[model samples]
Target: MNRIKTDWTKPQKLSLVALLFIIGKTIKESWVLILYFIVRAFVKQNEDEDDTEKRSDKLIYFLLLTAAFLIFFQIQKFIQFFKTRIYIKDNELIEQTGIFTKKTKTIPIHKIQSVHLVQNYIHRFTDTCTMKVETAGTEKTELELSAIDYLKAQDLQEILQQKEAVSAANISDNNSTQLMGLSNFDLIKLAISENHIRTLSLIFAFAMSRLDDLRQFFGKKTDAIIDEQVNQINFTTSIVAGMIGLGIAITLAFSVIRVLLRYNDMQLTANQKGFKVKWGFLQTQQKMMLQNKVQLISWNSNFVRKLLGIKILRFFMVGENILKDDQYIKLPVLQEDVLKKLSAYYQPVWPSLNENPNYTHPSYAWRVTMIYILPVAFAASVALYFWEPWVMIIPILLFLYFLVTFKIRHMKFIFWYNQTSLQIQKGIWGDEHILLNFKKVQHVALETSPFLRRKNLATLVLHTAGDSIKIPYIPLTKAQAIADRCLYEIELDKS
Candidate 1:
């Protein structure tokens, strides 16, 4: 193989500079020494009028030092600009970095799971993109060929995909088709249907923690402002009101912005070889996934998304796929007809398909409440009895929660299996449908607690490279039969 040498595009130097500036501002260092020096300076001076002037000079000095650090960081980036390089060698993907003390990393070809082509805003202007490779190995990203020419990066992606395909099994001449994609109207639908609670919680948690840090920096009580505000209403009301305000704030701007940036012009396509998912606005990312490597396929949406009649589909793969979007192979806002197309394409792949799955047995509902709810409620009641009689109300609410969950969710769970796939359906806010390709099963086991044993029931645990699924309170004998069948199919596939 010929040696291929590449480095970051010229515009990446500016990117590096901006990154350093952000990092410098974010670094936390105690200002005790500076405070001490200011106090000492003021105390030593007999003139009261001059103290304020002296403090201003100290503040100016602090700003000057911060400016100096930023400049130094940018200079360091320039010095390391020429030292980073990535190349391909026989049976190995290699990266060489650092200047004086050279650091080299080598990842075997078979270990590489996915290669994503990424192009950020800077890269768009420079006609360059980053090729990020993820492997089944320990490192998060096996290799990142940062800021290479856009077209060259794509050719390299094809090369890596071909290598992986050869290792898994050679691909046939199967025609590729665009399976599904989001239009501009669909993008707006996704934005409106986005679940912003997760984002809101993260932002609120982060802001509260930062406020604590800032309070210490200025020597103020962190809860002092909160205590004064709490005089207006009860704690519960304050919390509920605050969450409502923040949820609206996040949903309007942050959630919409996140959805737009990640899923803009989203597309999903597949051929006989596997599937390819591409999306993004300022930075485009391409994730190539082989069907054999797919461990779990789940389709779910929140209550908001359900009202919009859309769902987000995600496929869990064996190894890391280094895309900016969290879900490695995510399909955006798919509805009915498209779901039918996906089911037809995938369900027909190995063998028999059973669209009507057997619902969970009637006994599972109450049994689940005993295993999941009763003990927790008992403990909460006991703990609250000593401290607050009013907290006894919590146990009553929890029992009601258990009753609802049992009736609505646990009893409605469905499970089915055939030669090719195992389908699991269970969710509350929105229907979650999981389709697991039987050949991808890594291991299978059955678990039984004393209670389950007494009841002649067992939980079937199905393991895959990415995650596990469990079906609780099935007959022990039946669970064993299903496990045996799954094992038999895996053997057949291997042969």
Candidate 2:
């Protein structure tokens, strides 16, 4: 095994600013605010002096203090940086570092599931990036290089992949063929199809919650101006129209910019190991997943995508996808051939209903989900009974909700088990297929309530390292059979 230390380059030093928001060390992170308070204290002490002279002195003192504190802080960071080290020995990736308390971490190279490089807005200014090293069985990164040279990070990533390749005997995809690449025109189409209202609502919520921070960063008082304008207007007359128009304009602008920058000229390629995607305009990222490392493969589509005949294929990788919520290896607006290629790489282990016609949820499964909705509906109707004409719309919505739930829950809620894998088909608005191999199953839970016990119905839950799959409203006998089979498969694999 070979070993090396970080170069500790100039860009890494500048990246300290980025770490202010990240890295939750209370004392070290609070330095800037501390410096501001110290300056304020110094200014307050000299309050007896003349106002003009005091103001000049305060400005000078604040600048001097800011410079001194930052200089000392950088020196401290430099010392810590110099002490930081990375090395490999005996099939282990070792990282040793810490300021006051030294910490050493040794991770088996084989256990390294995913290597991620993350860069946000601050990374643009620093010309450096973060290397997140995650392993199986954990949501947190095992080791993280917060600020490292971008090229060096890539070199390290290649080295890790090479090591993993040696271990798994699959380094890259053999075909080395381009799977999909989004052109500018395609990106434009994506921008048009995006659901701006939902995006805008998220933006509005975040902005409302973080107005002070945004004001400090962007130096725009328009938020205050808008608030004043809204308060001036009549509450019920045209507020909805005005807010919607503003939201639409903001959403459209944000959607266009976001699509162009985030998904600009994105490309996906397949090699011997698995597939890798390279995307982003200003700040580029390369995300790859190996077949062995992928725990799950799922896809989703909104109304726009369904209309456009496109889908986003998401990779539920074991070690690499630690974020859990956000998919790193996502192919957006996947064309036909790419979908076929993806399916070929990751086929469903579970057989379709055509192959196993007997294992399906009963018609009462529709009412299983309705059990959750009726209570809420009763409360809503009672709450809104005073609002007569307006309340009439609620029942219409309630009917639609029940109709959709009934249509989805009863018709396609199916699960089939074979010796190799279990297949689950679910979802209402979108088609979601889950294939769980026996080896990947972490645990199996077979549950039955009083009602389910009375009806001989049960719910089966299968947990993996990444996520859980639940099959609700199946016959108890079937649930028990599946659970026993899962345990039997686990024992077989072990033996």
Candidate 3:
């Protein structure tokens, strides 16, 4: 450590755009203190002030304190940013951070799982992007270069991608292919056909959660405030209908806007290294994952998508990645033929869709009915006895829904496996098909309760690095056979 003379490149490596992030972080971290001071200053000034000079003096003091607090944090962050350095040295991506307590991190190029370059609305105008580097064992992005030149980011991504490809191989690791991209008309269609119901439900949930938050502030008065607001609205048929229409219109508008913003100019590409997905309008994102790291591939379609011959595809990569609940990449496939090609690329020897899958036991239907429908019906009936007849409507509707969907949900729960891969098909209105390479199976679990054992049925759970697929209410023999086959494939892969 004798004064290592190397090109550190801290000045060129840093971006002024990162000051925006630094300011945002400072505000986020110090918001409570900021708010507390402002509120205190206001309250003190308003407390029956006798002299204008005293009130002005108190206000000035408080303002000075707040400004000094914020300025101190801002200066600290600026200093840290100035001191931070990242560079490539000896086949490793190195980052040195911190001013007082210095730290250095070296990540081998081969260990990099993904490198994402993102440009939000602000970054786009600045010609800079945030590059996030993720590794296998880490739960979140391990290294994030707040802002870098777009060309420099691309070069870094290429170098990392080339390094990753050296150790990873896929079936179609040959030519660079533009698998799919959304056209203008297709983007409009996707936006229009977006699931407004799901969006509305999310909006509703968020509103309700906020209401609970309001309850914390308002105490018992929260309900009274809501009731007071509700009472002002005249409940005429026309008014009710207009409100419903307005809600639907709002939901549709929100969905369309969200879909457009998220998927505008979306493109999916395949290369010798892996797959890359680029999308978003206001905030552009480019994610690259290695082909060999993919453990499971799935595609699903709602009723609208099915009618339109469109499906949403998802790739599940290997690792203990728990951060992908909402962050998972979703690629839209417009053509069934394209989907087939993608599937073939992932699993060359997949089981045919026409093959008769091992369906769940017939008892699954009754068991579901007993577990779900009966309790709901009983609870509804009890509520009807205690309350008004209107209460029965919800339960009655739920019961009817269960009755209508019981057969499809239970009887259609089927799975088929070949020597190389396993495919599970399950859903009620929509169809979700998950394909897993047998060699990727990390473990097999066969679970049975006393009731299931008595009925000679067991649940087979195939655990992979990405997720778990549970095939329940199948014959014990079939369950065991599938587990055994998966273990055999796993051992074969090891060999």
Candidate 4:
């Protein structure tokens, strides 16, 4: 067993106080702004003011309000800092915080879902990181330790890991006769089935777009000069050359920055117990996932990434939402062959070979496409009454083409099931692969639209924790059978 004691430094405490002040100011000013607007609306005499007078008054009022809010918030923050102390004792984590309330929470090692060490530019400069520990719950009850030295952060992580191992062993010994385990091969399949490259490419493109926006905002003058130069290159050849040069420069800059920011010292490993991830540039983070805690798995690939042979894998754990953290354990980039091998371990239920099974949708796509087409065609017909009738032809043709694409895409859907899991694969341009444990399904629904009812076809939807997945175009009887089987499986698992 190991122990670590930690506290915030004076500067770090000031930073935390500043953060609280900002929050308080924002909240306080929000109500003030609303009230000021309402009061101003009644005082119409003041509306005829010179612009300079109005601006000056606004600035003075804002500064005064903010200063008062900050002064009060800083006092509250100082009291909080004086009261809080965090320390790890052997296999248990403890947080003793609060001024007048005097609250203390102790989380045993086994309950911690994940530990995250985060640092921004300021924290990096100070060689410290914020340690956050998540536990099992729907509420955002995270324990945060701010401004811990980098070496101390690493030492705490090791201590937590040791406690986790001991707790896991104890639980396994106690429950060995009752629990069913997911095999190492299953984890491997999960890793492989994820579309790593596609996911990475999408991530890269998004980062590049954001960076481009930031640059444009900060380098407005430089951008204006570049635009003038670009416009001056009037020759067709020179224009093409200029565009190509700009594109290449942007792409190279984006790629290097993205690789450095995201995958600096990236690592991924797996064991029979769980998956492990270590990544980051300034504040190295370690994330561990116990096999049983994983609730669902998904893989997604957009059209661009699919063309480039890339895919992204996502794991939904039992209690926490990955979207909140905005950090995912990634393979970074992987070849198709490597993906195939990893997919087998992570997503064994997915078919190894591409199966061109006939895909069918309930009448929903047709309804949606017709709904889209009717409006455009109606508008076009109305327009032709006043404008060129020829304009109608172009819109009519485009609408028809769009409708056809929707129909074709919606007609492509497939669902598969085995004794242990239900697999669903669907999408038009970007495919979505979902794997759900049959036991976790809360309920099953069989529904039919008017058209489907006429056709004697129905859809089956399985409801889980947060969302539901549907399988369409099955016969009514078959849909009922699937629903029944799912319900039985859920019951059996519970029993």
Prediction-by-prediction clash tally: 0, 8, 0, 25
Please, what are the lDDT tens digits per residue for candidate 3 over residues 300-401?
988888888789988887664656643468788899777877766578655755556678888777777778787989787778967887677777777777
Query: What is the lDDT, from 0 to 100, of the residue 470 in candidate 2?
Result: 82
Q: What is the lDDT of residue 118 in candidate 3?
A: 94
Could you give candidate 1's per-residue lDDT for residues 429-484 as a string of tens digits?
57787877777777899998887888888889998876788988888877888788
lDDT of each: 0.70, 0.69, 0.80, 0.62
By summed lDDT, the worst window of 10 consecutive residues in model 3 runs over 3-12
- How high is the lDDT of residue 338 in model 3? 74
lDDT of 2 by residue, 322-417 (tens): 355434565785576677577566664336634574344564545644676666777677677777757856865885688677776567666677
Using lDDT as the measure, name the better of candidate 1 and candidate 3.
Answer: 3
For candidate 2, what is the lDDT?
Answer: 0.69
lDDT for model 3: 0.80
Q: Candidate 2: TM-score?
A: 0.75
Candidate number that wins on lDDT, 2 or 3: 3
Query: Model 2 off-target regions past 4 Å?
Result: 1-74, 98-102, 118-129, 147-151, 169-175, 206-249, 319-327, 348-350, 357-365, 379-396
Best by lDDT: 3
Candidate 3 global TM-score: 0.83
lDDT of 4 by residue, 1-495 (tens): 755443322122323433444455556756765566667668765446689678967876986687677667656656666666666665667777677788888887677766677776667767767777767655354677665666666666655654575566533321211112223343333333434555457667887898688777877675677679878866798878997787655655555555455556656555434556666665566565554455567777666556555556666665665566443454533355545444444455453234334355546567776777778777877787578766777777777787777776666567666556667777786777777776667788888778788888887888765357777777787677668777888889778
The Cα error of candidate 4 at residue 4, in Å, is: 9.6
Root mean square deviation (Cα) for candidate 2 = 6.4
Model 4 residue 216 lDDT score: 75
